[model samples]
Target: MVQILLSLSIFFTSAAQAAEKAGMPQLDPTTWFPQVFWLLITFGFLYLIVEKIVFPRLSDSIEQRNDHVSDNIDEANSIKDQAEKKYQEYLSLISNSKKEAQDLINANKQSLQSNFDNKKKEIDKKLEEKMKEVSKEIDDFKKSAAGKIGSISTEVAKELVKTVSKIDTNNASASSIVEEVSKKYLKGLN
Candidate 1:
């Protein structure tokens, strides 16, 4: 700040001296050549510095930034493509898992159906055997009852004969005739 103030004071002092000596501050024809010469020198110096140093560095910085932006864009595009591939892979995996699960369920269903059929067949076979046993038992009971009925009929016939003839059947000795009559009557029933 102090240097800038000192320079400004010197410039104003020079300008006041020229104004006093030339009687016109800036439009004096006698000083025009020197002012034009200094102006040209300042512009030439500024132009040389800008062309030699500032412009090349500025252009290099701009190209570097552009290259960085381009590389970032390419990387982003590549990552997007990879993400799309991964998404397709994930979808395929889900589809395959569903198909596998369905196949397993179908196999289990078939196995269970076969097992159920086997159990039903076994139950039917057991029921058939039990029915045959019950039928045989019924036939045996019928035969035993027929034999008891024949003996019961003979006793009844002997009692009836004794009652009507007023003779004691125990002394008549005709039990064999009653047994023959009972057998013949039983044969007629068959």
Candidate 2:
């Protein structure tokens, strides 16, 4: 390859020198045929190499890269769809959990209210029973004290009569007199 490049340079240098001596041979019609021929050869060589080797390999590499990009995009889309589905499922689960929690809270509140009502009723019943027992005891005390009040009033009257008269009185007459006075006092109080 080095020898061929050296020979080509030598030939081009000689041709350039000869064209200079021949009064600018590039414009001369006599040199145009050879120049055109070499131009065609170089163009044909370049065209063949590009069409058969470089172009085919470049196009194949480009197609492979495009295919890889398309596959990656498809995979990403699938993953995105899956993520969306999972997100929806998670939302559904959260909603259901919230509903269940609310239901539980309502149930607990209702249960507590029922228990409070039952306890209130029990307390009311106990208070009523205590009140009834106290009233009955008061009635029994009043009944047992009735005779005692009468005897106490009779004794007080006899003492008063003795103090006023400074005289001994007949017991039967004093007793009857005390009875009549006691009846008048009880009536006035009523």
Candidate 3:
């Protein structure tokens, strides 16, 4: 296959050479050089326009777009960083606030406990004082009642003795004896 393709390529090239030799006009160097120079100039101009004007503009636009994208990415990153910082600060503040609140609650509990203790102590003291006052009042009442009963008993005894003896009830001797006995009984009670 390669030999066949090579033979065909040779045959076609020979036929093209024969045709050129038979019919093509000979080009003079002076005339052909000028045409070549013009072609080179035109191609150079087109290449300059493409390279210096069109290609540069396209490249600048691409660069601007890339820079804009990069700047946007950087700004987004900065924003994300700021958000993270704010979040951390907020968390710290909340933690501090919670600690402070816990401390305040503990302090309040202690204060309330102290107040309750003080109140209990005051109440206990007041109860003791009331008990003492009540006991004193009861003792005073007992003494007054005993004194009244003693006086009544002495008067009844004296009346009975006077009635039984049928002597002058108002005699000085009888009165003196009754007074002495009453004094002895009252002293014994004391």
Candidate 4:
């Protein structure tokens, strides 16, 4: 406080002397010392204010911002890692599911193929049995039809001889004639 009052008094005295000289105080050699003194005091005071008040707050603010940014980056990296891990797990799950599905499909295919083969074999066996039964029935019918044909031919031959030649035929002669005609017809067909 004393220094400020003393400096103010000197400044006033110099201003008065500069007014008497009728020139700029800054150019006056006598006032240069007082002017330099005030300049140094002002600069020193401003430096002190900046060093004590402004720089510490600025540094703290910058450090806090850096720390916040670092924490955010770390959290982001951790989340990214978790996401990658989950992705791998999902891929593994999908792969396993596909394999299991394929295995099930193959098993089902084999089971169906086995069933199909068994059914086909059973059907073939039934068809073969039916064919054999039909063949046996055809053979039995042919034999019965052949016996009836012989009797019918003998009767037909007797009636035909009575109509055409006006004479009756015996059963033995008609039968012999029908057998001979059948042999000739069969040979011609072959």
Candidate 5:
């Protein structure tokens, strides 16, 4: 459309100039040759400018844009690979840390269990010794109590015999006195 308008304007200007000049007269307006000639010349010049200057610069700009896009894509891919590698490394580190923690916990648990077992055994041994000591003390107490009871009974029997003898002095005879003397002598010997 621009080409057509420019050709018409050129033809009109050329016709007006020819008309003003007396040497060269204006051509017939009824013929289409002048319009056609001007249209061809303008179009030919536009084609040459576009092919030689405009199109080559546009192609260079397009190629530069494509190269920039390709470089950016490649850089993005490298960054993504690096990120993946770092993530994998972090995961491996975490996994190893967890494994080490589990091992430490297990070792501590075993150590604690062994310590508790040892303490329990010591407590049991001490308890057994305490029980034996208590049993020995009880046996000593029983023996001492039995000896005191026997001494008390013997004193009571002696007091009762002296009272009976004083009450019945006439009935108390010489044979009885001799028998009591012999019993005292036998007890002293034991």
Candidate 6:
């Protein structure tokens, strides 16, 4: 700051000395070479400072800022790619779990169906055997009842004849008559 003030003071004192006899120092032929010499010196000094120091510092700061931004962008892209890959892996895991669950459910369904079919077949076989046993017992009971019914009918016929007709009846004749009637009426039932 002091150097700039001193330079300005010297410039004004020189201009003031030339102004004693001129309309403008810059337009005066006697001061023109000295003014041009000082102007070139100041301009060259400022040009060298900007080119060697100020411009290089500004460019270096700009390059550093640009490199920092580029690195941040690269890191952000890498994180995004990793997130996408994890999402795909999550989707695949869910799909695989669903498939495994479905397979297990289907296997259990088939197992239950097979067990049910086997149990049903076993019950049906047992019921058929029981039905055959009951039917055979019924047939045996009917045959025994039929044999007893003939003798019972003969005795009932002899008593009915003796009481109502007032006559003595024989067992042999009653038996024969019962047998004949039973054969005619009960032939198709057996």
Q: Relative to the unseen true structure, what is the C-alpha lDDT of residue 93 in candidate 4, on a scale of 0 to 100?
A: 100
List model 1 lDDT by residue over 55-136, tens digit each: 9999999999999999999999999999999999999999999999999999999999999999999999999999989988
lDDT of candidate 6 over 37-114, digit per residue (tens): 999999999999999999999999999999999999999999999999999999999999999999999999999999
Query: Model 1: residues >4 Å from true position, as ranges?
Result: 1-24, 143-190
2 or 4, greater by lDDT: 4
Model 6: worst 10 consecutive residues (lDDT sum): 19-28
**lDDT over C-alpha atoms for residue 139 of model 4:** 84
lDDT rank order: 6, 4, 2, 3, 1, 5
Ordered from best to worst TM-score, the candidate numbers read: 6, 4, 2, 1, 5, 3
lDDT of 4 by residue, 44-120 (tens): 99999999999999999999999999999999999999999999999999999999999999999999999999999
The TM-score values for the models, in the order shown, are 0.59, 0.67, 0.51, 0.69, 0.58, 0.75
The Cα RMSD of model 6 versus the native structure comes to: 9.5
TM-score, predicted candidate 2 vs. hidden true structure? 0.67
Candidate lDDT scores, in order, read: 0.84, 0.86, 0.85, 0.91, 0.80, 0.94
- Name the candidate that leads on TM-score: 6
Q: Regarding TM-score, does 3 or 5 come out ahead?
A: 5
- Which sections of candidate 3 miss by over 4 Å? 1-48, 153-190
Name the lDDT value of residue 180 in candidate 2.
78
Give the better candidate number (1 or 4) by lDDT. 4
- What range of 10 consecutive residues in model 4 has the weakest lDDT sum? 19-28
The candidate with the higher TM-score, 1 or 2, is 2
Clash tally for model 6: 0
Local lDDT at 55 for model 5: 100
User: Model 3: per-residue lDDT, tens digit, 1-190?
Assistant: 9999999999999999998786544555657877889999999999999998999999999999999999999999999999999999999999999999999999999999999999999999999999999999999987886666656655666678768886545545555666677669779978
Give the higher-lDDT candidate: 4 or 5. Answer: 4
- Per-residue CA lDDT of model 5 for 1-190, tens digit only, reads 9999999999999998977774533455656687889999999999999999999999999999999999999999999999999999999999999999999999999999999999999999999999999998997986676555555545555566669775433323533554465457657955
